[model samples]
Structure formats: C-alpha cells, structure tokens
Target chain A: MLFVENRELVVPGRLLAEGDYFAGEGTFLEGGKIFSAVIGLAEIREKSISVISLQGRYIPRRGDRVIGIVTDTHPFGWILDLNSPYTGNLMVSELVGRKVDVFREDIGKFLRIGDAVLAEVREVDERWRVQLTASERGMGRIRGGRLVEISPAKVPRVIGRKGSMLKVLEETSGCRLEVGLNGRILIRGRDLKKVNAVVEAILLIEREAHLSGLTDRIKAKLEREG
Target chain B: MAEAKPEKLLVDGRRLDGRRPDELRPLRIKAGILKRADGSAYIELGKNKILAAVYGPKEMHPRHLQQADVAVLRCRYNMAPFSVEERKRPGPDRRSMEISKVIREALEPVLFLHLYPRAVIDVFIEILQADAGTRTAGITAASVALADAGVPMRDLVAGISVGKVDGTVVLDLMKEEDQWGEADMPVAVMPRRKCITLLQMDGNFTPQEFRQALDLAFKGVEQIYEAQKEALKEKYLPSLEEGR
Candidate 1:
C-alpha cells in the first residue's frame, strides 16, 4: 500500500485511512485514524500503515566485489571511485598480509592514479566513507584491456545466475571478461574487432538485463553477428 | 515591463505549427523504457521530449541520519544541450537547479519518505527537447516513471503550464509564448486531492488574471493527467494479466 503522493503504488503494503498527507513509511495508526502524511499510498495491514517512497542509487555492500579506479593515494590507503556518489578507500595494510618495508615516497610506485583495480567493499565507516580491500585473487589492477561502464544496478543481471552470463560473453567474444561488482567491466583481447564485439555484447547485456531468457538470446545474437 | 516588439506573428492568430490557444499538441508516452532504472519512462509532448528514471526505497545509509521512519527524495533535473535550439552548457545551472527544486517539492508530497527514514530515493529527469514547459513535462514524465518502477503512491501527479500572451490566457503555451508572455505558471498537482504540490509563476498577473490562468492550468492538468494514466495503464496492464 506504499505510494507516492501523485505517483503509482511503488510498494505493496496496506491501506490505513483516507487522508491528504503522507506520514513516512511504517507509520502506525490507532482507532482507524491516520497520524502521518499521506504522501504515498497507505497500506492498512491488520493495524498498521506503510508508505512507499522513491528509490535511490546503489551503494556497496560487504562481500560485494567491484571495479574501481584509483582517485588519490595517501600513506595509509588509496581512494577509489566505485562509480557511486561515494568513494571507497583501500588501505595499504589490507593490500599485503605481512608488513613490507616501504617508504612514503615509494607508495605511488605501488599504485598510481587511474589504475583500475578490483576489490571488495568491506564496510562503511561512521562517516559513511566506503572501505575496500583487494587481497583476494582475480582482484587487482586490471591488465591491458578495454573498459566499459554500465549502470551499477545492471551488474547483477550481467553477472547472471552463478556467473553464467560472464561465461557466455567470454566464450562468444573470445576475450577474457572480468566484471567488477561495482559495475566496471574489463574485456581483455588483442584483436580490435574482438574487443569491440565484447563491448557491444556487454552493452547488449546491460540494455536487456530485465527480461527472462536474456542470456540465451544474447548468445544467439552474438553467434549471428559475431 | 518593456515589451519586446512583437516579432511578426509566426502564424496569424495561431502558434507555430498552427495550433490554436487551448489546443494540445501531440503527446506520446512510453513506460518502462529504460532497462537499468527501476522505473523509467519517455514522454513526448508536442516537440518536447523528456525521460525520467526512479530508483529506491532500499537501505538508508550514513547511519547517522537513518530515520527508522522515512525515505529521502533526491531529484536531479537535467537538460541535454541538444534539447534546445541553442546548446545549453552541460551541468547544473541556476535555471536547472530551480527546476530541480520545484520538481522535488512537487514529488515530495507524493512519496512516503517516512517509510525509509535515512534512506534516499533519487529521481533523475532528463530533458531531450525544450519546446516549452519542460519543467511540467519533466514532472509528468517522472510521475509515469514512478508508476512504472512500482513505487506506491496515492495518485498520479500531473503538470501543465499556463501563460498570458497578447493579454490572453492560454493553455500549454509554446516556446514563443513562454519567452514573450506576460506570465508563465507551472503547477504540479495530485489530481485526486485536487491539491497542488508545486506552484511557480514568473511575470506579472492581475488577481483576476491569475485566477483565470490557474483555472486554465487545472483544466490542462486534467487532460494531461488522463494522458499519463492512460499511457501507464496501457504499458503495465499487460504485465498485470501475465502475473495473474
């Protein structure tokens, strides 16, 4: 029953009462009287009302791997842009398990700006800054390849169920495909035609991510077009 | 106000393209037009086209502002440089900011922000054309997008513009009227409540003239609202049957 003031029902909740204002989502009512703004639809379930509000951009979560670009470097960590409004930081300590000898001046030699890296969004600190780590294998500076940026929300769809989509893209394009959880995709190939083909495939995946049987259809398209 | 000398009428007593006052230009709306956005729609009103995307009631982060009670509405209104006759500079400007603020307010009354406290809902409206009433068009487009996204709302909000041109009140003013008209008023309202969530008027208007203009806008809004609902129903009704 959650709704916006003049939009459609976004969330299905319950109808609480008839009113002119919306009282946020999860609003409580007693004696059949609404006590909040009726901005969204009022869902009446047993004894409570829920309001559905608008949607926001995606944020990184724990255990989520993402593709990020190095934005800045500091003694302790390197700042990375996850293509989100918020940037994440990767600590040098997290990069290596064992402490290694390194001077402050030499930190830049290890990781420089614009170097695309794969990492995990560990946690958001109290200040809401994202912290990342790239200690795992298959997660590090992306080697020579073409990069494509897609909507972060489409990443899950592009990855498909259990890495199936990536497998298909790699097989068809004849390129090594690496999808960062943060929505950065890297297609590694020497042939320009193959690289362009892979990019087109990824874009197609992004554009048609919502429909069922998308992977199979995309495979067919690639087989025919490639 | 120093009146800019009336440039010879583009058409005798007719708007450019020859439409009369109170006449609506062709309108076409398509919902669920974008794949990545949770809900998206493209709207073409006369020569003006706009796309709107709606995303979330997910998790409210930053921990500090997280209200267990409501969601935040973050609206960004942008116009592509190619949207207008003259290329607009890319990025937010004073005009765009004002439109964004107005649109946010227009949508705020409809969203159940308290439900996802500390969480944020982002509505991005992109103008692909700029004939006139882009703000109203953007609002109308966003309303359909929210529906397409499945965001719950009490009712559909409709937006329309009214202006005074040559001492005459007109509905759905075009670009010329907007530039030379004595007043331009854009309103966003929840047709069900008959209440306005967004209202802005630029230019002079006598009390009677203002009332007349508002009435004209409301009439135009009813027509626009019907169009919005019909477009959404046409697009989503099929999904409903499939679910059944």
Candidate 2:
C-alpha cells in the first residue's frame, strides 16, 4: 500500500513510500503502515527511484540550437555564456570557410563582449563544458535584430508543430524571425512597431503555448492590429 | 501562467482583464500548512504557487562541515514536472541552482545563524505553479516558514519583478509580460535597510529605463513586504498572546 511519508500535499515538502512502481514528481503516495523516505516522489521512474541532486554545468546536444552571448575572445575562438554554468567556445575556423590569418589584437573586430549569437552544439566534455560551432548559413551572429530569452524547456512549444507558429509570426509581422532550440528568438524588421508587436506575440506564445487554439487567436489579433 | 489573448485588451489603460499595472492578480498565503515539516507555508501569487518548508536546525551528519559558531544554510529550489505547460524531467536544472544560491544568500543575511551552532538550517522551496515571479514569491514564502519555525531574523526580505513593455515600465509583470516585455528586472530587497540582496535582469533596456524599472520594483517590494508582515503577524501574534 502507498502511504505518505511526510505531511500534507499543500506545501513544498517530500512524500515517500516503499513500492514497486515509482510515483514520479508532483505526486504524493499516501496511505497506511508506511515508512519515511522509502521512496521520493521526485525523479522516480518505473521500478526505480532517483535522488534529486544538483551538479555539473549544462551541456548541449547535437541538433540543439542555443542562445549565446559572446563574453571573451581569444586568438582562435570566443567564449560564450549559454545561460548555464558551462561556457561554450566557438572556434573562429567554424565561422569562416577558409582559415584566415588575423592579428591577435584584432579578434574583437569579429566579435566583442555582449554580442548575442545563435549557435549549434557540437560537443560536450565529460565535465559538462560545451563546444559550439557556427558553420552553416542561418546560424551565426544575430545582426540588427531584437533577442528574447525564455526558459529552455519552453523551446519546443515556441517552435510549435511543423513550424506553424513561426509561419504565423513571419507572415503577419513581416519580420525575418529565427528561433534557436535553446530558447532564444531573433526578430528583425525595419518597422519598429512591427518588431515590437512580433516580440510581444512571441512572449505571449511562450507563456500560453500549452493551450490549444492559440494560432487562430494570435493570427486574428495580429491581422487586426498590424 | 496562461497566455494573454488580444480580446483581453486594455480596459481604461488597464489590462484587458482589468488589472492595473501595480495591482497583483491575486495572492494567498497559508502558514503552519504542512504537518511533516518543522515549519511550512504555501504561497500563491497569481497563478504561481510555491510551497516553502523549514526542516531543521538539527545535527549535521558526516561531522565534517559543522561550524562552532553558526548553522549552515541548505536550500533546494525545484520545479515540479507538471508545474509548467510542458512536463519537465524531474531534476534540478541550472536555473534552479542559480535561484537556490540567491535564496540561500538572501536568507543568510536575515537569519541569526549563530543561534544554532554546529547545526544545519534546511530550506526547501518548490514551485507548484509557475507564472512570472516564482523566485520572488519563493523567497517571500520561505521567510514566512522561517518565521513559523521561530528562526530569529532582523527583517523580512521581499522580492518583486519590474519591467519595461512598449516603452512603459510596469510593476509585477505577469508571465506573458515577462516573456514579451522589452526588459525584466527581479529584485530582492531588505525593506528595513533599503538595500537589495538579489538583482537580475534580462532583455534590452536603456540606463534610464533600468532606473525606472528599479523604482517600480522598490514600490512593489514595499507593498509585498507589508503583506508578508501581516501574514506573519496573523499567524504568530495570537499564539504568542496565548503563551503569555
């Protein structure tokens, strides 16, 4: 039988019980004749229970795009802040097709501090440090645009199914929009009003992306205002 | 927090749903709310609900890091998997760590650590429903838990978020405002000292806009601090009179 190890479920407290099936997070297993700490509700899986622990920096996976800000520059690469404990290094060679010799003091000419960019994750070391590369078109420094960051977990919702949400933003606001899978969005438009409108729309999407019938609502709003 | 639709537009310069810029959506706080914890409180600010618990001023095991002069603060900030629109994998993420660290620091200054030497003070904050200002709300609720635990503190810390949207600085942005607004600045303040314990900003803002946002945050903090004090007083004052 499942029983609560701790107190009521209204507060931020732990719940536990010895059982074969893992109850998982956000659940309380409560009943009779139970032992405390027998099983934690968070991080539990089928027939397995895992303790919650915090360590290591965030690492990026292949096909995962992230928002990065250039923090430091080196002779061959630039250091990037990926909104995680780990810092990513983008090699200069990845930016250009051919190896171009440059003066050591002139690295800042290419990228400087506080410059936001979009990059794809290439590799992650065992230590959780990320190595990034920007070797493809539509993947590099964001130019003449506005950038917005949201929770990384919300990235998929922002993109929507088969690029449907993105299509709406582009078609209505007439902005060239790029969304990195890592929760960064870039919106570029000559009209400040349109740019502002698109940014607001994206933010709304991030907040309410879980709800259904969102596209039609956003489309109608944009058409009426834009 | 749910998304904001346009039909929800402005009514008399207020939100489409009729909320003022400085007005809170709705707030609820309950103390002594958990039986298992030494002290606990559940706080709901708008759609963001967080529960905070104080577990111990107990013996430190492994016996290695115990200090002779003060108690160590152990804090864990977590988001439930179903707290957001998408189900998150159950674990601590980088954002949670950063928030936990700040919360630990915020409590350290307020708590009288020397009172519980060689022991540990454990604070666990969990986000039940996330809107825009989870951290701020967490910090506020944790203070209530600490107070309920009878932990001595100089003053309560209050947190709030201020931002610029459409060239207008607003106080206590909803989730949608935070996501779409041009800038968001969350601050944790000590009302007694008028000093800030935690501050973080994202998005674009001019220096002037930053100052304006901070001003708005200070205003918001004052209002929240009063509510916190009221909640604490309501919880403990009657009990204190009974003890006497």
Which candidate comes out best when scored by TM-score? 1
* Model 1 stretches astray by more than 4 angstroms: A1-57, A100-105, A171-175, A189-197, A221-226, B1-25, B28-104, B107-135, B138-157, B162-185, B190-195, B201-219, B226-244
TM-score of chain B of each: 0.91, 0.90
* Model 2 steric clash pairs: A3-A31, A4-A30, B8-B16, B9-B16
| lDDT (tens digit, per residue) of candidate 1 on A128-222 | 56788887777767778898987665687678889898888788878887787667888898777878877887887666555557788778877
The residue-by-residue lDDT of candidate 2 on A156-218, one tens digit each, is 656768988889888998988878765678889998898988888887775554445777778
Listed in order, the DockQ scores are 0.06, 0.01
* Candidate 2's iRMSD: 16.8
Interface RMSD of each: 7.8, 16.8
**Model 1: what is its DockQ?**
0.06
What are the lDDT figures for the candidates, one per model? 0.72, 0.69
Query: Tens digit of lDDT per residue, candidate 1, span B5-48?
Result: 46642356676567776767788888778878878889888889
